[model samples]
Target chain A: MRASVHRAVEELLSEQPAEEVTLPLIATRAGVHPTTVYRRWGSLADLLSEVASSRFSGDIVVPDTGDVREDLERWATAVATDLADPDTLAIMRAALGAGPDGGCACTADRHAQLEAILERERSRGGRTPSVEEASDGLLGPLYYRALFTQLPVTAEWVRGLVRKLLS
Target chain B: MRASVHRAVEELLSEQPAEEVTLPLIATRAGVHPTTVYRRWGSLADLLSEVASSRFSGDIVVPDTGDVREDLERWATAVATDLADPDTLAIMRAALGAGPDGGCACTADRHAQLEAILERERSRGGRTPSVEEASDGLLGPLYYRALFTQLPVTAEWVRGLVRKLLS
Candidate 1:
């Protein structure tokens, strides 16, 4: 039942903007009572956050081969690809609107993964940036362009950013 | 009459999210007929785009003093400050939803301002990155962090990014 609700929300999000999605509509599509959804998720925002967390957990694979630059490049490229997808962008927008704690689990997981990668680099004698710095320097620009400028987060663009950060 | 409508929209946006803002509500707030707003702007998205264009035109100030880094830092700091405002973020989100051509004037003005600054640098024999590259590397990250991370885009942070890009 939870999976059905999640799948319905995902379908609706892909078809329309997040703002247009409603709990009643999701309930009808999922073939579950609206009360059931409300009981489990509390609100659309909460449900979307859970959906995003589940999707990201399954999708994100942090690559580490001891080379910090290469590893970061791989991870960033994957992120760029995911973010560029319309479906993922809709899910992200929903997650963001759910408030800070709303997306806490997904964000914490990503931060933890980044921290581990940075730690490995530090062990290898490379200058490891703080998680905040890495996020600001790397993920910030990628998402910014993806969300705002309507610019393509191309592979070459990702490579250039990684090189610049490493240099 | 136009000023009243603009003011009413701004007031409404500040009080609530952009999605909830409607033409009838704005008209009522402005003490004008809904037809008046509909005739002038065509749609809520168009009205929001015009509001954004007007606001951005009055707000953005690009500085140039023969130093690219200093100029970019000043410009980015101003942007960060503006973006940090709740009202401005609401308008930006609305404008962004209106599509590329929807906010064409504001975007064109910013791009032109950036081009002029880069042109000055090029004349001084500095390595000028493409406008797209500059947008991706500098503005992209700044706006990205500002919007998504809940991290303050501090003056120090702007300075660090400018230095990194320049180096």
Candidate 2:
């Protein structure tokens, strides 16, 4: 039932805007009562936040190719690619725009991945940016472009960010 | 009348969360009818978007102190300072979360400011980053920290970003 509801949400989001994905519509599509959705998720914002957070949680496989720069470039490129998808962009916008605090708990997952990469780099006796630096330099720019700006965050651009950070 | 309505929005946003600022409440505070607000702004999101956009529009005085690095640092610091305020943060969150395309028309103002700075640098025979580079490096990280992460976007951190961009 949970899977069906989530699937329904994904389908609906891909088809329409986040504001239009009301509890009634979700419940109707998922073959559940509106009360059930409300009981489970409390609100649309909460539901979207949970779904976006879960989708972004721990699923980003941290790269470990021995070279930290290469690993980071690959990871950033992959993220850029993922965000290029309209569905993923919609989910991201929904997540960022959800809740009172702006629903950014999903950042923790990406932060963890960066820390892991930095740890691997440190263990390999290579000079590396602090996790904060990596985030400010890499993920910050990557997401800033994807969400806030009309610029296309290309693989080349993502790789350049990695190079700048390492440089 | 428009000014009063805008003031009401600003006051309400400063007083509470963006979600709580409804059309009827705004209309009541502004001493205007709900129908008037609806006729003027169409919906709550449109009203909020207009309010936020207008608030952010052309108000940022871009710094110019002969040196590109200093200029950008000061400007970025000023921005960081503005965003630290709860009122400004609330307005920003509203603007970002508003509209179907995420209500980022305000970025054009900042981009124009950056372009001005870069143009000055080029005319002075100093090698400088492209406007896009400045955005990706400076504005990207600055706003990324301000909006997404739990970390505070301190002046020291912002200055460091300027230095990094120049280096």
lDDT of each: 0.73, 0.79
On DockQ, the candidate that comes out on top is 2
DockQ-based CAPRI category assigned to the predicted complex of candidate 2:
acceptable
Per-residue lDDT of model 1, residues B114-161, tens digit only? 777888899899897888777766676666665455676788988887
lDDT of 1: 0.73
lDDT of 1 by residue, A80-108 (tens): 88877877766665665444433353455
lDDT of 2 by residue, A18-127 (tens): 55567799999999999999999877768777777777777668888988888999888877787677787676665555554444765778888889989988898988
Query: How do the predictions measure up, each by TM-score?
Result: 0.83, 0.89
Off by over 4 Å in 1: A17-19, A34-47, A94-109, B17-19, B32-46, B94-109
lDDT of 1 at B11: 91
The residue pairs in collision within model 1 are: none
Pairs in clash, predicted candidate 2:
none
Compose the digit string of candidate 2's lDDT tens values, residues B1-167: 88999899889878864545677999999999999998998776677667766787788898889988889988888777877777777766665555444446547678788999999999999999999999988888877787778787877898899989899
